[model samples]
Target: MRPLPPEALPVIVAARRTAIGTAGHAFKEVTADRLAAPVIQVVARDVACLGVPIDDVVLGNCMGPGGNLARVSALGAGLGEAVPGATVDRQCGSGLAAILMAGQAVASEEMELVIAGGAESASTAPLRAHRESPDTPYERAPFTPAGHPDPDMGAAAEALAAARGVERERQDDYAGASNAKAVAAREAGRFAAEIVEVGGRTEDQRPRLMRPASLSRLPAAFVPGGSVTAGNSSPVSDGAAVVALTSERLRAGAGLPGLRLRGGAVVGCDPALPGWGPVPAVRRLLGRTGVSMEQIAAVEIVEAFAAQTLAVTDALGLDPLGADRERVCADGGALALGHPWGATGAVVVTRLFTRLVRSGAPPGTLGLATAAVGGGLGVAALFEVV
Candidate 1:
């Protein structure tokens, strides 16, 4: 890839995330803003040496109180009344989408510095009811119109598994490996640097040693007599993650080591098969950026469901069970780390920052972060260590 002008280049200087907590468990009492404030504060403090004022705070949120979550979080972090905030909602892809928006602002020379990421508190998301039927509550809003098929995420994952010929054994094995990897990484303190302690919890709430044998014994969770199971799916969780992005000029002045935002793409697909979104999104991103999958030193794809994850890897010609798997989710994924919806996208990017930048990888080492959205959308971003 060719070099971009310093003023128009966007680089991520710092990233931080609160420890993930299982919904209805560790973070049941916390609100979304509270979950995100500490992370934003830490990320902002980390980049204070750059001597650039944060122009805006952009956050992604799927479910929460109706007002602007980004503003609420920014204020909660004590950023004062001067800095402004915006929110993005793309279902599961919200976090990455917000980051892409921030990068665009910097790349377009519209802003010099921005705080961008996502936060979610499934435990405290507000209930909903249409105005016409005030007494009746709905679990979620429609992803498509009346004529289009809009399946629940779990059902869609099950259908995807059946259509893609992903076997139950493979899903269970993949999930088991993810858990094992996460446990090992935690024991080795691989996640210590990226995680910010929250609410007296110093470690992620999920991730256990789940062997394939034990996983195989679990029954189907979505469809009767089907392969998808709770054991192989990401749990609804609460957490927040944020990254500080600034122009390359500012980064150079500060002598900071960071990840340069190369390019990104967002694409839509059939609502019924939302999990397949990552395939085309990634393809378009690589084609647009003139980068190939072989060049990416690390890849992070949100693991919403084992079946969905397998389908995506298979379609992309990635070997989830082979040596290539090491380049993907090296420390495990949402299956082991827990999926905090809007926050998972930023979480993946944070993982990439840790893998490529914090680990002292060579400059220009490329990495990719992609996620399948809940409402027929996919988001992908490419980065290079600088």
Candidate 2:
């Protein structure tokens, strides 16, 4: 892992995402390809000032049709056939993985400008069946090897909470706070710059004006007597997000010197406690970048569940339910915005972009975006406002 030349490091110039739609509602009729196409187009148009041809379009997908979906998305976005595409699938980490790969390409000078992101349309996810019995539907493939402990995500979150001593009341309170922040951000038009309309929908479909009493009343979802509840977990979602990455010269040409890719790490954790994924990933990222948590001005860790969110913060030695909690997702997170599986990793990064770039954070400020994935994986990235 040799460091890339400073001049060749990837710098994001523009980024955008479609307002997240609930799985069975706003975007039910859309496919992953369709949801992603327009966002890529918007980034391309937005970054045209760079005057550099897009060398590739890399996208992450989870349950879309089995084909070169990045190619389909590139074509659909009108990037033309000449701009080849690649797709990556690390389940929930797919989107960030794609962006990581593209950023490395730019850092290595293999490309000048690249479009990278991810999309997911759970509503349009094809019904999967085992090959042994083609007609019998299955929910998903095994995330771990046979006979190894594998728990449903909700169950894992519950176990993590129990292990970490995070109580049900705390989880419910966190969920309520997340929703309130999201509602406030929406009302203040904080997301106006990064959200693009799709299918005539202009706003995210997941943010809720939840009352604490209401959140406390929601039933547990994973296990009997468990703290993990419907109110604290991410819902089925559909959305797409993208960012334009280029070298320093190209970013300067675009006149929008977006966040610079400082360092990134993808790490594996225990399959049984998959929610702990971000712990190792973020640690590795900090180690690589030589940046301390104290210097990170903003952070967004995907909140698939409040329990996992708490566990991650505690593992990072931050106050899971205190000031650090506010620093983690000041404008809300997946708990409030909805986690569109494959697209969530990119969504967090897009959130970081808005915070550092659109919100006028000063140069040298540090931002981090991270996500825990299905199958015991985590992805984390460090960005510097440059």
Over all chains combined, what TM-score does candidate 1 have? 0.97
- Residue-wise lDDT of candidate 1 within 1-386, one digit each (tens)? 23465446799999999889999999899999999999999999999998878999999999988689999999999898998899999989999999999998888878999999999999999888888998999779888889998999999999899999999999998999898889998999989999987899878989999967789899999999999999999999999999999988899899999999998889999889999999999999889888888888898999999999999989887887897778889899999999999899999999999998999999889999999997798999999999
Model 1 stretches with alpha carbons more than 4 Å out: 1-7
Q: After superposition, how far is residue 360 of candidate 2 from its true place, in Å?
A: 1.4
Each candidate structure's TM-score, on Cα atoms with residue i matched to residue i, is 0.97, 0.97
Which portions of model 2 miss their true places by more than 4 Å?
Answer: none
**The candidate that achieves the highest lDDT relative to the unseen native structure:** 1
Task: Please state the error at residue 325 of candidate 2 in Å.
Answer: 4.2
- Model 1's number of clashes is 0
